[model samples]
Target: MKSTVADEMCTEDLGNVLPSVYKSVRLSVASPPLLHVNASLLLLTDEALSEVFGAVVEDSEEYQTLKVLRKGGITSILFSRPHHANVLDMKMVEELTTALHSARLDPTTRLTVTAATGRVYCGGHKPGLDAASGLQLRDGLHSLVKCVLEFPKPLAALVMGPCVGVLAGLLPLYDVVLAAKGACFQTTVVESGETPCGCCTYTYPRLMGHARAAHMLLLGHELECGEAQRSGLVTEVLPTTAFHHTALSTLHPLTATPPPALSHTKQLMRQPLLNPLTSVHGSAIMTNTTQVISMARYFAAGVKRNSDNAP
Candidate 1:
């Protein structure tokens, strides 16, 4: 049973549009900075891709590399779980937005997005050094969230491991989120000797409320899948083995909907959150930037001490 549209657009001899169905399960080495752009359904006009690559590249070194790979026709990004922010960065967000915007504008282009990752999506800490460059960092975060919020299609995130910090903070914003059974969602800032992340301050409170949020922030415990769902964070929990099929099953209808209808519906649903995401990001940029810069200095001092001790 072939999808009617897939059958028409993809070559029949290629074994039922399977070839056109790229699953971004690995990262392309060429795009070193960003892990994966969720490129399983990457479809963009050459011109549009170029413009996006150019804009985002100018803002960050990471984006520069990503731009080159995308321009070189590197399609379909599989997640390699690269070390960056626990969540998205300015450049990655911009590129994602550019891809979606182009798809929305192009009548011929259709977009289907499913975000997947390894056992651990992100288990990294943001640099405290960025705190000194608060304004700049804030701008970066602002741009990142704006893109995620504004993307015009069904966006799904597949959580396979401990989703923590910013990644956990942003999960509620996605259209659909599927977590592997036993996978945990953690907000370890308090336990790890760090202040709450910018986004964490806003999103955490909303999702778990002041009391539970305070508990997580103060104690910094990892929430199991059942707890996460009870807290209204994880939407669905599937056994590790069933995650793939279940996610696809969930996304199949989203992919099948008329592009226009999908876009319209998504936009409507997201409309309410738009103002809040923007506002939260604004405060996040300011606070997170300052925190990042300060953290960087502490990191540098620790490095220096370690070097001196070695001598």
Candidate 2:
């Protein structure tokens, strides 16, 4: 991918500023004498910052399912396919993985934020796939979740509507989850006769407790925003009118922190989960993939049976 002029300038600015910021953070942590050092001096000028952050990079390539917009050290990955209810099929999953990968490499992006268009954050998996496409979808979803887990920078999810299926599975992986009023979350894997993917087996229990996780995954419970917040699944819930503003305000602190320190903190916090998650990721994905194929075939047979018996 060719770097745009704005991207190049942002990279240059980050190159100029990050080393000094990293040094200051290191010094502040290592030696008491340097604790009072001013880190703000390393910040880029307002004009340069505007130029770098204000640039919006639309996905013009093969995968146009999402838009990547950068502003003030934050990269917002907005779901673009409202017509499809932002379903995470194989193709969209691949695109999301690629976007996250690019954001991870982008020097100016200190944090990544995810949001979707329309009323549903994600409507769930693409329906009715054969065994081959099911396996492909499973792999793509696994890759997408892995990218989110391994992303060095902080990850935030801004939920303005219902978040369901595989997308709901990803909520626990986010560092911060800000939901708008009326937003709900549910995992429909059981309903579909498939197991959970994206390490939800591990993350849901940790984030929302064992009982709630079991209730959700096993019984297919839908969690409203308040219940989600109480269960610790959501960081906060705000009015739809104020969600974007509140989310930005909440993320403002990260801009002041050194990127290295932020990344290090995120890594340390995630290390324990990562260890167990790695071992299970492959097996879970494979199991779910097989289940998806089987479920599809079963449903197809049932539909055929009904059609044959119908008038």
Candidate 3:
């Protein structure tokens, strides 16, 4: 019997890599376990995390990293050590979400999910991280959409990054949201100077209307915090210094909600989005999985070709 590529990779090899098959689960709480749910902030490696941030801020990778974390039951408050970039890349999302889902299944545990980033989280400097070419980006988004559509629990996001990209649109799906001070929102595929794809264009028309959505997609203008609030994009904004305090406030209320209520509310809210979107999302994911395997193959081939070509 032949071993599958997935079977060939060990958990160690799977970590810290693009489209990581092995998800790393870290227990962040310091105190002894409690009956009530606690908050979990998910993040990625500096380079990987930075990639997601930069793509949205610099290039617009669809800001799907935040989408992924929220799906898996964690409110991703992305923070990177200053000077280190905080870009939530695909591998990080996968591992973090997998960890969250795993933790959620434990009868004793409960979690509140939010997404944010540190001052400097980035993927490495390489075209491989490009959103259009990003196997991991698409894969990660696919995972989140699938999970979110059918998830038996509530999820939310905190958008605070250069490129709020797809996250702003997705935030409306959540029961609650908090946008950081100075955190601007935009769905522009042009002014952001990044090529906007199908996903970027869909949200506005679906949520608002054709004319409004077109203004956003075509003008490439950003919605400042106030504008975002007016547009119903952001629920609230806090001074950068107050992000933690605001998070505590947002999460505390969430923690107090009974698990069953949270789960039920999440399901009901998701029905409209999930009903029409599931088949499309499912097809995309299947395609994404295929692309990942193919990308991995090409990656391996390039290495071999390089070795053979080298003197």
Candidate No. with top TM-score = 2
lDDT of 1 by residue, 202-282 (tens): 666788788887776666656777887888777888765545456656655654567779778888887886777777667
Tens digits of per-residue lDDT, candidate 2, 1-311, equal 55443333222321123212111111111112112212211111223223333544553775577767787788878776545556666778888898899889999888888876444466677744566777777778878888887888989998866677787888888889998777778775465567877788888898788999999888777788899999888999886654556677887798779999999998899898787987777778778867877877887898899999999
Q: Write the per-residue lDDT of candidate 3 for residues 1-311, one digit (tens) a residue.
A: 45332223211121243112111111111112211111121222433433332212212243334322222223343433212223345555565456446435644334545554432122221113333456556656556545444546555555543333434434555556666555555442443223333243444566667776677667655556566666666667665544545654566666566888877777676667664565555554565456545666676788889999999
Worst 10 residues of 3 by lDDT: 22-31
What are the C-alpha RMSDs, in order, of all predicted structures?
Answer: 12.2, 15.0, 14.1
Error of 2 at 98 (Å): 0.6
Local distance difference test, each candidate: 0.50, 0.69, 0.45
Ordered list by lDDT, greatest first? 2, 1, 3
| Residue 85 in model 2: lDDT | 50
Where does the lowest 10-residue lDDT sum fall in candidate 2? 21-30
RMSD of 1: 12.2
> Using lDDT as the measure, which candidate wins?
2
